[model samples]
Target: MLGTLHAWQAVERGHDVVQLEREPEARGASVRNFGLVWVGGRAPGVELRTALRARRLWERIGERVPALGFRANGSLTVARTEAELAVAAEAAEAAEAGTERGYRLLDAAETKKLNPALQGDFRGALWCERDAAVEPRTAQPALREELAKTGRYAWRPGREVCHLTGTGVVDDRGERHDGDLVLFCTGAWTGGLVRELAGEPPVRKVRLQMAQTEPLAEKLTTSVADGDSFRYYPAYRGEALDALEKSQPQTETARAHRMQLLLVQRLDGSLTIGDTHEYDEPFAFDVTEDPYDHLESVAGALLGHPLPRIRRRWAGVYAQTTDPGRIVHRARVAGNAWLVTGPGGRGMTCAPAIAEDTAEELDL
Candidate 1:
């Protein structure tokens, strides 16, 4: 989200910006996401602060780009088992103590008070009042439309860049685009783009699959995740926090075989739920409908009650790093050539603020 936002910001600031993509049409990972501009995780920490920045940026953009369905409904994380509740208690205490990302622990009565959709037993829930979500299908197009209006940018969606030479970029078509700067937002395909540039960092192409259930007529606006959700990433379990306290970077790979499921409800009354990750490293990126069943099965478990009906299913990919922090980097390759990428999965949440900051970065 940040890199794309930055690319557009660069365009707004009088720099000629050209965005390149590989698909004959622009669709996948970037658009096929929960559209969640969330700030509910590990409260008051760097992650929360960054999410808050992105969350606020979305708010600012929503002022004009109304299509960007940015909703500040907050986030609710439920604890099903006693062990999970204990962990939730720790997180809530940390949040209350002012960890930087403010997460409050609400008891079961309080949890159900706000969201009656919660059906199962839970000791308490983690409430992040600042988290928000946006439907990317609408938001991304609005952004592109706004970028188009700037007139300083050209969105070469069908063309994929083969490499870059100083201010010139060579596309797969054998054509080239030279400008004052070039930014990469290719998501999972960034490793190939990285090889074309200098200083190759460790990269993995991660595939995440998601689905939407039939609208329940009455919808819950907030997002939800559980113990199974905690296992999907180490940070939700506080291991990330503990590791960071010891000068260690917490890194986690979503166990593909475990069928970890996390669920969130969208504004249109449909249930947006998903995702198990498969890491196809060093020359692999695949999205298949076969994995849809895996995700649906987990969603069924996490929801505790039967999902009304599944209306759509799709697979998307993003770049993943050993250090779970987003893969966002901007460095000079040769002379004044600049390169930026590695958003991993949180791009949508972080992009708007990132773009604002990128817009402010003066050309040296």
Candidate 2:
């Protein structure tokens, strides 16, 4: 996504851009995510602003590329406990006090009214009308196709960059693609070329497991989230959240695995759900059923019905900066070569803004 955004921005500026992909297509964290352009959970200031800008960029880009499947469906973080409800209320107040986050604390009735698919017991929900989604499975291909039409963009796939040339990079194919500048948006594969140029980057890899269910009988009008999300997002921090944390802590397994329930309905009516965060290296190659079971139970309780049969299950890994303060680890690898990565789960949410920042900094 970063590479695509950079290329798009460069092309828009009347500059020729070449995007080289290690795989035939992007098959990394960019595609493995829930495709959520989540805005409500971002940190209160700079992060939130970046997210909002990216949200608008996504909508604009989606308009140009219909196949992106962008939807301004909004989101609801359902609270099932009193503590959770307090946190939601506080978040609503915070949203009102801050920027136009479009946050509203919805009662249980209102929550159900907005999303009829949610039929279970819940105190209320935090409604963020600015939240949206895109079809990650097709977003890149769609964007690349649109960029190609500009006549200034070129995509070279199946080229694993192995060495950095003074001007550009040399791929494993032993071909050197020359360009005035080079940006490495390598998602999770941070070794080899990246390490050689950047030197033991201050980034850590994170692993997660996710699954998708068969098409549902009814529509989930908006994306859905469980109270567990409050613990994971920074925006929910405050007196109320602190109180909730002290009164009602996460379950043992959830805390151990860093679990959160982020559910979004696909354009095909199927529900995409996940996920558990694993920060430690030597990540288990095998996907465990425990996290999936927990997610299923939580989602089922909120929906007031059993989830449709899960159609697919998988695990993925992405790089995250060890320094939480930095959104991404953007550094000049060489005089004209740059490496921009480590947006973590925010990759899909803030790719455009990140690339924009990169472009501005490099005067691209």
* Best model per lDDT: 2
What's model 2's TM-score?
A: 0.98
Quote the lDDT for 139 in model 1: 72
Give per-residue CA lDDT, model 2, range 233-272, as digits (tens): 9989899988988999898878888999999999999999
Candidate 1 local distance difference test against the native: 0.65
Model 1 poorest 10 in a row by lDDT: 248-257
Q: lDDT for each of the candidates?
A: 0.65, 0.91
Candidate 1 per-residue lDDT over residues 1-364, each given as its tens digit: 4445766677656777777667755576777888877665532456556667777778988877777777787777776555666666676676343444457878888888777777566677777677778886667667777778877767676777776777678998898898766655556555566666655655556766678888765457567776555444444657533443344221232343344455667667888877766664442344455456655544454455677788887777776555555435555564646555555666778777656655566441
Give lDDT: candidate 1, residue 61: 81
TM-score of 1: 0.82
RMSD of each: 4.9, 1.1
TM values, all candidates: 0.82, 0.98
